[model samples]
Target: MNQLFRLPQVGEADAIAEPSADLRVPFAQSGTFVCKFIIGEPSDQAVCCGAPVADGKSWCAYHRRIVFEPARPGRAR
Candidate 1:
């Protein structure tokens, strides 16, 4: 089988890199310009990537690619 992407398994979300202090923002501070990707545990302490989002996108280029990865060609099926 040919795989174009590998989705992270459950409980692996916490492996996300620690967001830099300057690039982290509380959920309430997120907006069109801030990456909407949530990081950290779901709680008042959680933050979103405050990195500048890609043009016209709610997430930064990195996160966008993770969420919208292209599907693998299915000819192998």
Candidate 2:
């Protein structure tokens, strides 16, 4: 069972490091339209998702879903 969930290989692990291999822009380098989705902890040192935002929104669609939990119709507030 452990084999089914092996730890990441050498190169794979580096992909998720700070300033991700996907070219995640640091908060300093970010433009207004970029997603404000923080990836890690320590808000001051955290990195944003760096994807474009949804229309007139602070975060991208993916991050929007995470940040805003839509209320279920029948659920009590």
Candidate 3:
């Protein structure tokens, strides 16, 4: 059973070090739009989900759904 759930391979660590370019949103001059997800060692880096956000919210559409949406009754997560 343990074989069904395996840890990430050694080389896989590097792949997760940086977010994909496609997922990053272009920074605006005023810097009004910024992702609430923080990255980096000191936790200073922020993610840009490449999309607009709803009013009165900090995270982008993707993050908002993951962070705020309620889990389904039969879902594992």
Ranking by lDDT: 1, 2, 3
TM-score of each: 0.57, 0.59, 0.35
Clashing pairs in 2: none
Q: Report the candidate with higher TM-score, 2 versus 3.
A: 2
Error in Å for residue 29 of model 2: 2.0
Tens-place lDDT per residue, model 3, 1-77, is: 12232246433533433334565643332145555443333322444454444474666545654566543334553
Task: State each model's CA lDDT, in order.
Answer: 0.69, 0.61, 0.45
lDDT tens digits by residue: candidate 2, 1-77: 12233345533633533333374667767788877677777466677778765486777766666677754435644
Q: What is the lDDT for 66 in model 2?
A: 63
TM-score of 2: 0.59
Candidates ranked by TM-score, best first? 2, 1, 3
